[model samples]
Target: MARITKGILGGFSGKVGTIVGANWRGKDIIRSIPNPSNKPPSEKQMLQQMKFKLVVSFLRPLGSIQKKYFGLNSGSKSRINLAVSYTINEAVQIVADVPELIYNKILITKGDLTGFQDVAATPQAGNKIGLTWEDNTVQGNAAGTDRVTIVCYCRELGSFAVFEAAAERSALAAEVTLPTIYTGREMQVWAYLNTKEKNVACNSSYLGALTMI
Candidate 1:
């Protein structure tokens, strides 16, 4: 029998304390080591970068797992589970100083076929509506001939910001697309956000959400 590497599912035991401590301390320490000119990264910059990297790393395994374990019809349950751990941690770490980080929130406002009508004039097989930040994309069920909009409610800020391209055609689903360069039972989308801007918040929804048609 061919040896099957369990991959992440093999359940490798990771050192929690070591990983956390090293990630937390190493990030700050390295940035503060100072450059030839003796200028060091600000504490805020360190924290932002660390948080962004951590979230992207966490998503690394999730994307592959999704392609392997779940397909378009599997719904969002598995993806949600994979994302929660990293999402919560990123949320906590980013807002450690500012309570608003924890308090400010995002949620799915609209779901189902009824809401879809409002977004699309003649909803068909490919149209969808949902909240997306930078990369986050969520698609609704195409049960009815209506446009669906998934609204995300942000607590600190009144009302949610709907994605501009929520109803646009999918770049991935178009027919004349080139053949996939690589084939895998699994895949993941990794993102690295620039965190140098002061007072600019990292968009947590960049990966976007998607569901079965």
Candidate 2:
């Protein structure tokens, strides 16, 4: 790789001949494209690709939440990148040759903020999901005004519904209505708290799953 410094086409991007140029951080750089190989993928390589695809697809919908509350960016890696790496490595399981996400092991948000206590998720009337938790404000870095975020994932749909700032820690309760399409599906629930200023977040707690009414 070479930094593009002082040239007629300064800071160029995209492929030109055998080299590809793009901006990284703030610098323009170019690198030679590796020649395509005719060799078949190894079994290990295929397994790795499967794991990567599963993690990326699962986390893509939570991009906004991950960007705000996931681990801090390290060097060139963004928070989302960190989240993907963590999920792929620690939260995935290979069962009977199939890669699957361990719902409870997934972390929608990661930080040092105080988390919830005695949290529960239950089915409510009219396709609504009820969330309840004991108020633990002022415990560690928690506060009464801290915002709560709710995440619901329906495996049948391969999708996620996130409610940001659904309620405050003081409320101790909140309800979310699933889309009509999810009316009969089972959903895995998780919740986390963030400061009112959105500066920090708590590790999320999975509150178990329920069938949407």
Candidate 3:
């Protein structure tokens, strides 16, 4: 094998016949074109491809939600990546060909810390969602929580709203005003406690559906 060092031909940067030249990580490199395959996909290949499609279809729309809500608050991409990866892995089990990351579709927490005791949501007139929760820390101490993260999901319209509120030493309840388009659609609500120790969050508690007025 011939290794063409950068000092030899300087820096090459285009495709020439069967060989392509490019710079990767500040180093110039050259490689031959891959041979085309005419073979049909096997059963396992088809199944794996279907699984990937299923997972991607479900997870693709979540990027916006993650970017808008979790990206900043979590401080790093690790947590968001973990959640997305886990959901994708779980998407392999699609009994009815449903491609969605529902509340019950996968494990919510990576740790055993208890989440919110009880949570409920109601839609007020002005396209507002009022959320209430009871802290389980009083009776039993879980991981010390710093904030409550609420996910309001509208299953019918594929829309959502995210809210965060202070949780330490307090019951931690608040409301979020959604867009006017979300007024008439029913929604599912979930609550999870984010710990004081950063990047650690509690499992989600299904707060049930809300009748948006």
Once fitted onto the true fold, the runs of candidate 3 whose alpha carbons sit more than 4 angstroms away are 1-36, 42-51, 57-82, 88-101, 106-109, 139-145, 155-157, 166-169
Candidate 2 runs further than 4 Å off: 1-9
**37 Cα displacement, candidate 3 (Å):** 3.6
lDDT of 2 by residue, 96-125 (tens): 988999988999999999999998989998
Candidates sorted on TM-score, descending: 2, 3, 1
Model 3 TM-score relative to the real fold: 0.60
TM-scores, all candidates, are 0.21, 0.92, 0.60
lDDT of each: 0.28, 0.90, 0.61
Per-prediction tally of clashes = 19, 0, 0
TM-score of model number 2: 0.92
How much RMSD separates candidate 1 from the native structure? 18.7
Deviation in Å, model 3, residue 95 alpha carbon: 6.4
Top model number, TM-score: 2
| Pairs that clash in candidate 2 | none
